[model samples]
Target: MNLNQLKLFYLAVKHQSLSHAAQELNITQPAVTKGIQRLQEYYEVPLVHKSGKNMELTRAGDNLFKIAKKIFELDKLADDCMAEFHNKGLKHIKMNASESFGAYYLPEFINRFNLKAPKVQVTLEVLSNRQVVENSINLKNDIGFVSFPVKDRKLNSIEIIKDEIVIILNPFHSLAKKKYLKASDLEGQMIIMHEQGSYFQKMIHDLLEANNVCVTMPITFSNNEAIKKAVEGGTGIAPISKKVAAKEIESGKLVALSLLSTPLYRTFYMIYHREKHISGPLKQFINLIQQ
Candidate 1:
């Protein structure tokens, strides 16, 4: 089958108008009609029949339309793939990271990388730790920064930084006066928890359970900013990364206190698919962050 004729038929069926297809294809209406005629003649089946001022596809046309749709879609994808290689200087790096590293640390590294490779474009998304790991494993992102060490053999996980998690409370809260708090200190206190099933939430729960500490957790937030805002509003105290709440702590809107009995610390890991080719822009970003 002639692809040119197939494309004309596809477009005509897609729009349900021969003139509209001709307009888009930048050809005369008769040319489009002839193209469709050739396709129907070659296939020995009526591809389309005319209604009152409209074209309707026959069963064969509908079936061929489905296959042609996929063919053109793949054609466009091939074009895009080739375009990327053609514009070598305009490289793109996609990164998925946990909330803390994405908001606090990745920006500085991206800024530095921009100074070095101005042509490279960096796209960053803040996701949960598990989402980051999943994106890395699926090669959806060129790199990922996650809160916990990934044990997947298909991924290369490198420890990037160690962050301390501390309890943050409104400056006016009674617990704000304490230099340090124990898990027992949190007992009976209203706690603002991370979203259920998050790695951070699990870690906090494990710590509290290990110490036999129970706190009233009535509110949950998926992001640190919301948790900090809630704590500042005196809704409840929250356990979050110190760096994440540094601005609030410095402004006295919140107070950060370490856990005396079991200090919470989490290491952030830089992860990427083991088989992923280290492109120049990706390598530069990894190096800058590692340094």
Candidate 2:
């Protein structure tokens, strides 16, 4: 059961010479013999016999040698894998983020990171703000981005960006020409809402309620893309991050109207578990994004 003795026996069987095995092991020939002797004693079998200046393995020794070959090969493979990781030859990063950051912001950072570390594989999942925080706290991901600050002892967060919530309307909508709009401007208008209970939905809801603005909520979508599409199709006006609709605004497919009475903004934060190990590739990615 002693690994050292098994190794000695394996090496002796491999070279068919105790002297050669000892030379490779950097030990005395007598030491190699004693090691093999201990193995044979423990197994209660004659593993090897001298035959005309060469060593031959018995049937039991042949079977043990096969298993030893596999064991040593696996050990070597494990060493090689660890060495590659230490050298940063192969790396993977898993991340979770809210839809706004994941869909609109993080792609640029990921592209830049890939240019720097082409070998590192990156995976990103889009979830709600609460889901991002929960995943980060549970160590389900290496990093996370959320729309709001997270206050958890198990997590470390940094405010990465501040995003403004803007009203997105169809370019042909009557209010699209207005430079800005007041809460009353949206009264009785069909409002495209995010999924119920979402942070974004709550933010828009609170803003409207605070100003006593009553708008008809006719449609709800779980993701920004769907909401934007609905707005472009003239389904209703939607309140969303300006950055999320930047392309549509630039293309004149959608017009963004600022809130004249109460401006709304949300902070995006990069979060990770305090106990998570920041590997070389992961640190590089964090630096690239933060920069």
Candidate 3:
């Protein structure tokens, strides 16, 4: 079977119209029709039929569509896997980061790195700060960006940056008008929370617990972005990293309030296995980060 023709057939079946498939594939409508016709000729069975203005798949076409979906998915997966193979003097760097750094900083940083070394490929995985620390200690990732300092003797931790955690609020929320928020000001207020066991979440809990302040937590999210969106939609207020709220704060889409006289902050650490080799591309990346 011709895979190109099969691709066209899959697209046609997916969109339920040859013309629509043609538009998606950036090919002419007649090309899509011919491609499907070739598939039918090869199988000696009709694959599609017209009813009014819509196209419907035959029994054989339905079966082929299911198989085609799996085929194309695997094909794309293989392409991605092979692209990551280390060869031709190109280096692949594995990075594991906390959600905030991964979402807010890494993309632009990686783009800049790409311009500096086009051949180096960096794969990033966003996880909880604890997971980031564990992966670095276990050598599961080459580098880890996490909020809390690492205490493990097997890993080397370098202080990267300090992130100030701020109280996030909807633009029109009652608290948004406050220049500074106190622990007592937030008592009994609805709040969004982070996932359990998160380092920053622990800090927030500690700060609140220390002041004997309690808030209603209606929902929890695993990442900073989701929590920000929930707060933007007026779900509730949350204490989050200023780095994560920079854009929203600047645009006035969200308000970031200071906590009374107490400043909440978390230090980000760059960690790696002590025994891991630092050379070539990895060394270059470390230099870039340090700079």
Rank the candidate models, highest lDDT first: 2, 1, 3
Residue-wise C-alpha lDDT for candidate 2, range 1-291, written one tens digit per residue:
998999998888877888899999999999999998999999999888889878888999889898887677556545534654676656888899898899899998999888888899999999888888987775677899998778998789999889888999999999999999999999999999889987778888888898898999978988889999999999999999999999999999999999988998978999987766677777898888788
Q: Which of 1 and 2 is the better model by TM-score?
A: 1
Stretches > 4 Å off in candidate 1: 1-85
Provide the TM-score for each candidate, comma-separated: 0.71, 0.69, 0.67
lDDT at 271, model 1 = 94
Alpha-carbon lDDT of model 1: 0.86
Q: Quick one: best TM-score, which candidate?
A: 1
**Candidate 1 local lDDT, residue 36:** 90
**TM-score, model 1 to reference:** 0.71
User: Candidate 1 — worst ten consecutive residues by lDDT sum?
Assistant: 73-82
lDDT scores of the candidates, listed in order: 0.86, 0.87, 0.84
TM-score ranking, best first: 1, 2, 3
Off by over 4 Å in 3: 1-88
Instruction: Provide the lDDT at 202 for model 1.
Output: 87
